[model samples]
Target: MTDTLLTPGAHLFQAVEAALAGGCRWVQYRDKSGDHERRAREAQQLLDLCEQAGARLIINDDLALALRVEAHGVHLGQGDGDPAEARRLLGPTAILGVTCHDSLPLARQAVVNGASYVAFGRFFPSRTKPEASPAPLSLLREARAALPNTPLVAIGGITLDNAHTLIAAGADTLAVSHSLFGADAIEARARTFTTLFNQHSST
Candidate 1:
């Protein structure tokens, strides 16, 4: 299967538009806390942009908003909804991702519970949410060994500086945040990271 790379954390339409310019295939809107009305509006705008760009948009931790906006998918952490329940609510075609942190057992359970992809992270120091659990490269290695066909996403502190190392460690997707959109020129940052991602894929 082709690797699925995601560029998340674009807080503005201009930033997200810039990311699309840089060839981002999948984007996720991941605001941890915000007013409901504002979140829904932002998600709707993002969904429209993603549709125009032909990129899939996944909402982070907001299933109801995602469903209301008809987003391409929804990513849920352990504190969020159960994957099986999400599947039941979203139906067979709706994409669902689960956050497994550093636990393989939880990952296996998520897959069985109907998660389309599993995300694990904090592989490096993360400025976005420092309190998120610090996972190890060893987690990726083990995850790959156990679930080769399943899409394994690595998040947190993923930057161009250490991207290749993470890819080599067996991450199918690099779910990044500040590394790309936390900048003035979102296109440039996205292009740089996408270029590095392509290089590693070609290797």
Candidate 2:
């Protein structure tokens, strides 16, 4: 996730570039500044960077921007828009992710609505969204069982220390923000995060 505050100004792209170089395969452009021009420019740049690195870029809550930049996909929060409509517009190949919070029912609905993946969390305290409702680790387990075929994303307050627990509990992806871009060594942090998944898969 890209945050203007976390990585202000040009540092955003630099941080993302470092992450990509460190084996990060997916990036979600998550600036909520409402600056259409800047967002579009940054999203396009991020998309280009991701493409060059053989990674995927997902625009957050901005279907129009995603389409404008021809991004890999768009992630929709509950109030963002209709996932089915997004799916139709993005076509079958685009990756559509829906933030289902802690509800399995919402996740199920998202899948039915053509979401490529469903996200659940705030498993731990979140700096990005402090007031966001907390989701239990068991939610990941339950979602895994219920949405067996869909990719499950664990979001909110994810860090290297606690990331393993989420993956162990059945989270296919970890959506991190502060802990990653806020690190002094963004590349190393990203590499370590990627290593966690690799180590888990090998086991």
Candidate 3:
């Protein structure tokens, strides 16, 4: 997932473009600045970008903004909103992903409540979310056992150096933010991830 985080400041659009340019098929618009007008405009812009790139757009934490921008999905954190109601609002086909942290039970409940995917996080130290909840590589394996059919996203501090471990442990998507966009070579960083993912799939 591509996130417009705190440090990347002015280059948010460029960050999304960098990801799309690197053949990223999914982009999550995660800006938490609480500026409704700007966020809506930016979200619309990203929706257009994703449409042109054939990339899926997942809005983070904002159900209205997601629907307003007609995003492909919304990723919900614990305090974001209720997954069931989000599913109802987002419709059957709209993707709904939930952050499960390190809890298998939360992941199970999310799936039961119609979450299309579950995200576990902070596998490595995170600059974006330094105080974020920590999750183990073992959690991914356990989550896979519990929700075999559900797509699992491993978030927080995921980088090319350590992402293979997450994939090996059963993470379907590595939710990268600062590690990809915080760098000057955004496209290159993204490619590293895609390359890693591709190589893993082939093996």
Q: Identify the candidate with maximal TM-score.
A: 2
The pairs that clash in candidate 2 are: none
Clashing pairs in model 3, backbone N/Cα/C closer than 3 A: none
Give the Cα error of residue 187 in candidate 1, in Å.
0.6
TM-score (all chains, Cα) for each model? 0.91, 0.98, 0.95
lDDT of 2 at 139: 94
- lDDT of each structure? 0.82, 0.94, 0.87
Which residue runs does candidate 3 get wrong by more than 4 Å? Answer: 1-10
On lDDT, the candidate that comes out on top is: 2
| Candidates 1 and 3 compared by TM-score, better number | 3
Looking at model 1, report the run of 10 residues with the lowest lDDT sum. Answer: 1-10
* lDDT tens digits, residue span 1-203, model 1: 01112333343777788888888878888776557887788789888888998999998888998889999889998999878999888888888999998799999999999888999987888876578898989999999999888898898888888998888899878887777776677788888877877887787
Instruction: Please give the TM-score that candidate 3 achieves against the real structure.
Output: 0.95
